[model samples]
Target: EGFLHRWSSARLMGRRSPSQRKRDDCESSGEDFDEDDEDDTENEPDTRKRKGGARRPGGGRRCPCGPTGCQRLVNETGFRLPANPERRLAWLQCWYPPDSVPEKYLEKKQFRVHECHFPADAIELKEFKKSGQVVRSVKKDRLPDVPFAQIRPAATDQPRPARGERQTREAADATRSELDRIREWVQHGVETEDLPQGSMEVLTAALAQGQQERDKHLRTKERLERTEKRLSQILSERDERERALRAEVRAPQAGVRGMNALSYARFCTDRWLKKSMSQWLFFDAVEQLNAYALLLDGYYPLADITFVPRQRAKKTVPPADGERAEMRRARVNYPQNRKPALALTPRDALVFWLFVTRSGMTLSRAGALFHISRGTAASCYVTMTEYQLQILRREFPRLSAQQIRDAIPDRFRKFAKQQGVKSDIGHILDGFEKQFECPRDDEVRAACWSSYKHLYTVKFLLGMLSSGAHYFTSRGNPGSVTDPDQVETSGFLDLLDEGIDTMVDKGFLVQESIQKRGCICWMPPKMRQNQKEATAEEADDTASIARIRIFVEHAVLRIKEWGWFSSRQSLSIQQADLHSDVVFIIAMLSNWRAPLIA
Candidate 1:
């Protein structure tokens, strides 16, 4: 340092010794210094004082101890310097004993780290004589006065933010503070009593609004579904009402009003509206009904009963909301109300009734036949059926063995009468299946589906006298029912005498029950693969039974001549309902007609 000072003083005074004079000559010579190498000398890093700090005239400012801020830190902070001056900036925190009391700090120069460094890792560790636990040395709380630029500002600086931005920043700071507290609690088991302040209300309100919006959309969807259902129901009701009104308006033009041949010819022009004049009036088969109604007089009204043209809607018109129709329609009356307040003569009624029965026409067609609506046709049929049954009930008393035996006509009773044996008179028994209804459910379909008929049907136990007339009909039951069960429940056994002969088909399974009641049931022989051949007597008996049982088929055919029995039914039920009455009426009508076979 003293040599450097002397050199600086001599350079300033322009006085130089011999060694310096030689050095100056060599440095200034062009032979020693190349022109290209001058830039290298200018750009090289120097250990001299930097330019930013306050610089004095003498080379650079000196520290309070001697020259640099580093030297002052070394002297005051008890850090020992290396023996060689070149090694001064190479050491980091290399200090001596700090046991002595601190001396007064120098006011002129501030201490700072020139090149901060740490020790390198050593693979070989030195063992201490102390315990196994390793306690590291701690650092002091305060640091020496260092002249770092961040510690002393060269220029005054202040931040600028908008009002909203400022508030947001403050909120962020508060959140960060809370997070720091939570982190401290997690890491060091530390906690704070109060939560950080921020706007949780705004977030909760926004969430609630979104939830309400979603619920509103859901409610709107449900309401729309309900409205759609109601509209569809209303539309269906409107269509039905329109159809009823149309039928009412068009009913009056259907039938021609007269008994003369001209009126009959005019009505027969459209064959679908009424039966043809040749088939109804000129036909000999149906002419007897008019004579019979005349012969029976007041006892039989089936061929002469009449009904006014009633509007179909009058029966089933929907009541207006909160109010009922003034006249609640009454049910059809049978024997008491056979005659309409105003109607055609008995001859016209007979022609219409026979035409409908023989033609197998629908009730709708029956309505068109006599200038009436469907409702009027239904009422007429219902009343006529009841009246006919009431008359027969009076004429034919409850059947006893003697009466049933006596009912056989000339052809069937001839053999028994000639043989002088009532037991020879036979009653044929069989089951007839009629179309019932369609089932909607899978289970219902399985139950109602008939393996025999290959369709839905209702089964009935039918009996026909040897005279080819219907004797009795057990109420209709499910097609799946066993024939023997119907035989047991029909109460026909009660009317049988000690030796009544009943003929039946092979499928009837009721042969044993008839025998138990002391009645003989003749069924056709059944051939099984393993069974022995039947004797000639069994074969003859089977053939004879089949011949006699065929009359049951004829009787059933006569009943099915009505379209009501032949057409598909709207509902399925057993023998106990209104459907049973319909079957009962059909059986009675079959007996009323001429014998089926001859």
Candidate 2:
């Protein structure tokens, strides 16, 4: 009757067992309810506590303590209680202390906080004062009343910030900042008993493991990309070799089809002889090839870094009438659109490419060594040099004021203490001379001879940044000219802007010219007998300037390491820009070897 009345009549039970009646009678009597003869509900295990002694009533989540006893319950543990009341109650039962004061323990909560940014100098001076140091230089009365990070502000003290305020720190980021150990919890949906007491430590360990796995995945991704790139390069090589083979197969049918018997025999014999040439040892390493070619490592100035020109038809004398007909060109297989004028193994091609940078080598010697014609070698040299000049022309660097600041070294602070930079722009410029070949033309030879060096030579102005990197190289000038004249003629002044300071040797002698452009010049003190010995300050200034200026000379030395440039035979009279181009290329190349400034 009770079940039918509690439920709708249509869903009523027909009868009740004696145990059920007994349980209902015990509940009504407000005593310990027992089901010793009965099992728990169908969903729970039989071993589940069902009665008293810390048992949960009806297997539902409620405080284990009675309502009267639970009024003093407190969330004292340093963890975020579960959102579910039942799970939270269960967690409290296991972790809550049994023998502590009954005072209520309230959980921590976050609240909106306000903060401020202030004149950082105020904070800095205050800290110094607290450390028992007197900073009398910057007076308290004249301090600026503003925040600053970007400027050369006036040399004055900063105003005091408002008293008793907390500074604002950036919001914590889980990815970039360390996780807080307290007042925070791991967000994983874990029950209290399922987690360790020091859950934050656990989370930190897990995050570390996750970071390591992410790094491993990134390394694997990079490795796969490198493998894919190498495979593609190999495929291209295979295709090129196959095309060349096909072209060779069709030679008799195409370029040499109409050759007479004698002409064909001679052609076949010459082809076999050329094919027999083998010189693989010259390019055992790519660096060796670059060194031989007077280039930086793993580079060429060609359209294809490895490709070479194909052999052209040999120049022949006028043929007599009725003579045996000769094939005008060699019969070989190649694609119609092939840009390479000749084909050889990449190694042999690199060998041929490097042959021109050698001094005192004629075209015949190069051809004999590489098994190519003298004309082809000469053509490759001309083409490669032009390409190098073009690339450098387009890609030269023009640094801004901020980059110039970065190029300045912290190591120069010692000098700055003595005499500081008033402006942001700065450079260390100097002139370097390299020997050149005396031209056959007497006028050109006389014009290029340097009285200082007493050798046929050319000079250039090199400017290096403070960070040990080459910034600029002036065009080649006649070595006969003075350093100041070389600098003026090479157009180094055109790059100067207001507030730039150029450091030069005693030879630059362009202080007035630099000052005219509204920039500063730092040069070593002159030692004239008419003048007394340098003062201590002047000596310090010269030493500082010399220390920085030495880097430009070191950069110049790196360029001259190329034997072709260091030796005396590389300069040419035919190409007006040849010496300049070589100087620029090597100066640029030095930037790759070691930075010039820092």
Candidate 3:
């Protein structure tokens, strides 16, 4: 009936379960009977009447045994009652008994009432409610303001267990493993464990190894330093011994005076007096004769001696029968005879010799010095130079007239042939020929020959100076000058001018000029010609002259260094030619002396 009533009420009000309504009615009626019994016997019967419809007579209220009620009773029997059930149960579905605790905690003997108890301040209300006393609301007290230093914060500073104390069974096993690794490092020079598992052991072994290596390195460095010091000491001692030995070796050779005497003697013997004295004397005589020839003749003699036949039949036949006798006579009257030798006197001979020896002498100066007329001096100087050249050929058998002819170039020989030039041998024999056509007066021809020979000498000398070639001589001082006459004559100057002209013609000289007179002369053709209005022909001519003249000048300066050419002496044409050959030989020697350039 309770279940029915509860279900009926639940259905009507949607509030009570069937079991809950039965339990509630039983409690209400039982409470009312108790109240009636205390009040009056008369009310007990009404309570009983009230319960009659739902309750059995003489039996307590029928037990409400629905599935939900039974289950609730079972759950309630398992639950513990709280000290203040009404209040505590309001927010709780279940409670724990005072003795209830985790089994593990209990087994470990760590469980205690104090471990689960609330704070002392929270127990008052709980106790009052459990005793059914009237509870009053109590205001919570405000916490005191605590200083930051006094407050216990989280355990940031807690000391960890020391290595010695961390000895739980598991930790002890790990420690034993670490010990074994250290022992392995000591015994085998390596760690048994990997880096991650035994980082500390690895680090310790590495440090120890590094320390040993450092000690060994330091010892090696000390040994090296000691070795270096010993080596340096030995080297210094050896150097000192060497110096002392050198000083001892040099001691006996230290007299300056003796050394100087030896040096001077060597200089005189080797350089100054190159050959035997006899050779020098012979050369001196030859040199003097050459000067004499230049003094008498205005020009030098022929370089090589030449010989002419003393007598020859005149080429004369009977005139053609038709030719008029008068015409023949007139033609014959034009001096049919040629003088073979030029007229040269004894004084003329001396002057000629002097002139050949000294290249040339001023006419006035010669006259004044020798006490003669200037014209006479000039005449003698010119005539005698040619005569001495002829005499030289006679005296020197090695030199021949044919050789002189051969020395001339083929072109010149051809020209001579075309001109029908005749060689005179005995022109000096006749007074009429000498008086009418004097050989002494032919200065120009003599000068030309003299100049030619001098040019050869200059060329040789120049080659020696420029190239450092050696000039050998039987007399031994090839560089020394013996015949001053060979050099002083204007022969070299004439040759230079001729060379320059030849060079200019060949387009080896260049020049600059605004006008004809303003032209720069003898410049190399390789350089540009700067003649403002020059014709190409004119520039080319000038350039040729410039090229040939430069070499000639260089040759002249080199020969001039020897005192022979520098002195004031006259030279005959013959002496000049001989000197030229000598100079040529020297130049050849010079050429041979130098090493061949790659």
Candidate 4:
């Protein structure tokens, strides 16, 4: 029956389903199968249908190929499961039949064998079966068996008594006792029995002493404050007194104007006017004028006028009889006498001299002093002063003419020379010639005396020792000197030349080499000295020179102090000489009134 059954099952399994048949044919030819055909067959049973419509004689129908079922077999040997039919047949064509059987049955058989091969370990089996029981037993053992009622805290375990409460009660009792003691003490007063009688006395004495010390400190502070106030008051008063004394000392000297007679008066008057002059104008003006006059008289003299002309001229005519006779005749025929025109009234001249004596007074002050207007004063003063200076230079010779030509620089000298013009010395002598005809013998003699006297003044002003009383003892008998004779006999040019050389030799004037040529250089003496010799002594000498040189400056300044020298109109020779004479007189007066040393 087994043989028959196996054979019948193989026969039944040999038949292919309609889809399998189609799939096999398609695989053999490498054709595509319709995917819809597989879907249509999905509901169909996975059973093989035999050919000739016969049923196989098996308990269940199986594939005829058995382990090598024809329906599962692909062409030749191998096979692949079809995909959704399009490339399915092509894919299956490359497959070969399996080399071994599938492991599904083997895996199931091996699992069954594994299960039967060994039982679980005895310990594991026991633990798996008794786990719950053991867990219950452990939970029961870990838990306490005490009754719920016994778990409550005993009444004895509740807070017993607090010692603080007891202590507080005791403290309250003690405090009550203390209060009773305090009340007793308050009612009876603290007993001094514990303290010694001497101690109490000592305490009382200390308290008294402290109170006294405080009182003493208060009194001291009060006294100190009073002393400070007093000191401050004293200081304030002292300061006031000091200020008053200073004011008194520094108060501008009452009417004693010094070198600045006119200017000081004007300044005081102006100051007084600004301060309180509405009520004191006339008084102040008179005071100022009087103060100015006082200063003038103190520093200036009235008998100091000496008239000299700008030029000393000598007449010329041909000599007769013999050469000497002809020369003498020529000399006699020549006009000799010349004098200044417009002589200053003695008062007017004195007023002007006084005005120039003060350092700061100008022509305007002279006008005020003489009651002349400023313009008239200035014009007359300049003209007269210039003429007088010229005359002084001509007659005195020592005073020296201050020619503007001296101010011309060497650069201009070259230009002057190019233009056929001479240097300053030449120009000055030429100008002298044009202004003055010539000097006569008598006039020349007078000039010599005048020059000697003027030289004395210059030496005195320059702080040089005068040739002394012995030399000038007899004013009428001036020593007849060849130098003076030469100056007298020579022309004005000769005198100028001699004067220039003498001044240069005296170190009062300097000559500089300009472009290899000599020219006059006017500078302070100190500036001309050796640099290394500029010591204190040299400085003092320079200062002395500077101080005395102010007289020379003042002589020049006086001419400017009066405004006449700056007149536009040409002055007559006599008037010019008179002006020069005024300058000479003023300069002489300044020297005369200058402070004399014993």
lDDT of 2 at 532: 70
Candidate 2 lands at a TM-score of 0.43
Residue 51, candidate 1: how far off, in angstroms? 99
Task: Count backbone clashes in candidate 3.
Answer: 69
TM-score against native, each model: 0.44, 0.43, 0.17, 0.19
- Which 10 successive residues of model 2 have the least lDDT summed? 108-117
lDDT of each: 0.55, 0.55, 0.36, 0.37
Better of 1 and 4 by lDDT: 1
Alpha carbon RMSD to native, model 3: 51.0
Error of 4 at 20 (Å): 94
lDDT of 1 by residue, 356-424 (tens): 544556656565656655665555555555555566556545566776666665655554454355654
In order of TM-score, best first, we have: 1, 2, 4, 3
Q: Of 2 and 3, which scores higher on lDDT?
A: 2
| Of 3 and 4, the candidate ranking higher by TM-score | 4
Candidate 4: where is the Cα deviation over 4 Å? 1-346, 356-359, 390-598
Kindly list the per-residue Cα lDDT of model 4 for residues 135-203, writing each as its tens digit.
Answer: 111121121122222433333544545755543566556645655554465477776455456545544
lDDT of 3 by residue, 67-105 (tens): 111212221112222334343332122222334422332
